[model samples]
Target: MAGTIDPDAGISAAGEPITEAEALQRLRQSEDQSQQYYAAWWLGRNRSRHPEALPLLLATLRQRRPRDPGAGVEENAIARNAARALGKLGDAGAIPELLAALDDEDDGLREAAARSLGELQATEAVAVLLRRLASGPAGAGAPRLDSPRLQEPCEAMLEALGAIGIAEPGVITLIEPFTAHDRPLIRSAACRALLQLSGEARWAEPLMQLLDHPQLQVRRAALMDLGAVGWRPALEPICHTLAENSLKLIALRGLVEQGAHHDATIQAGAVLSAMDSLL
Candidate 1:
């Protein structure tokens, strides 16, 4: 019975096709290194088709052992792949694991976890991410200059929170604090998140206040988010500001994208035309 098994073939034992349930069982019970790796691969590849497989993969990754510290080579490989799978699956169940991995010492693992959380649109991760932002260089738990790389993961987490579209109560609360962050980049990212979550009327006031932020980029992002929020009346003053400010082209583009017409559009068009003439 000398035969080659297709690497892409479905889970099977002795060439007998296995049901998802059977594959899951094997994934949960298997201790053999080779079998675990194969199970991880199968689960990662078929995560969407078989959502149940996600928990099994996650469980396998979470369980730690002395010999297999953090599941060793097999576990790390599976966990990384499973993170990608969970992203495609967009399963909320993977949120806790993904969030936990956000601080993983390994950059690749942290990125995978952050990305998966984004794909899942897990609103719960918003609080943790906001905390990371507020804690600046001197603040407790802040990323140090020695490990500047951590900032990327932190930023990725913020971007993920924005993409998740989670309207957590804390999201609004974090807005004011972030507006004052020492770092302009963090301030800009926070403004972006606030805009992303401001589907409700509550975001209107905060967004308007952001128009006055000292940083030009923050001001621009605030204007863009306001436009995206489609608060027609709010665009009035912003339109006036854009007409006077040379660096507001991006904000103007956002307003256009949001179909912000009426008096605001008329005014913005005049400003844009004038700017074009000057160019």
Candidate 2:
């Protein structure tokens, strides 16, 4: 059972099917750290629903050890992987662990926790995220921030707030200012949150503009933000964007899903047609 992972094939080892038990075994008892990491990823990818999955992952979230200085990472890899896996699993039970992880000493793990919180749609985290955003490197009313001054965790908080879909004026006030943040990623993230919170084309428009941003990463961020917005009007720009077909398909699918609120059959046909022509 302790072999290589064939991700595309969805097998754990030796081309054998991996059940929930095997993956849990790897995560719980495997001596190889890499095996544990892969097990975590497989659990999340398959969305394992076994009784032990959550507790094992919660334990992994606290697994700590020093990395090889050569690895260029300082935080525990297993914990970070666990944080993300919990998000993908869509279990609200992860909320407490993830919330505490927000204050983690590791920047990367904090970002992972914030992202998972967003995936969980943890409404309880809104005010706490707002506080972190307010104190973040790109905090409101702060001087123009350079690229380094903006952190991925701040973007994660903004995206989390948006994903939770609360429309309080105070939350809007806190998030709107970042739409103009110096970093393109931050600006795109703020725009994404605004669009998700309000369903406004005004927010979607800036994200569309970012599609042509000079940097590929910025453009990719813009595409993802627009996808999260699910603004039907973005279909054209998303189709024509200079990104990979896979990303464009993802954004387009979001449009189809949102538009389906009105008419599913028609929206799917239209989106499929658009993909046929553009992708």
- Residue 186 of candidate 2: its Cα lDDT? 80
- Mind giving the per-residue lDDT tens digits that candidate 1 earns over 35-66? 55566555555554675677777876565232
Which candidate number maximizes TM-score?
2
Model 1: colliding residue pairs: none
Q: Give the range of the ten consecutive residues with the poorest summed lDDT in model 2.
A: 1-10
* TM-score between candidate 2 and the true structure: 0.84
- lDDT scores for all predictions? 0.56, 0.75
Please provide TM-scores, in order, for all candidate models, with all chains considered together.
0.46, 0.84
* Every model: Cα RMSD to truth: 12.4, 5.6
Question: Against the hidden true structure, what lDDT does model 1 obtain?
Answer: 0.56
Question: Model 1: runs farther than 4 Å from truth?
Answer: 1-47, 63-78, 102-108, 137-145, 173-188, 199-279
Question: For candidate 2, lDDT tens digit of each residue in 1-279?
Answer: 000111222422333457778889999984787678778877987898888999999999988554455676444767877887899899899999999888776655777788888889999888778877775444532443543434445677788898888889988998887887777888888888888888776887789899999898788888777766667777778888897887777777777776655333345777778877655
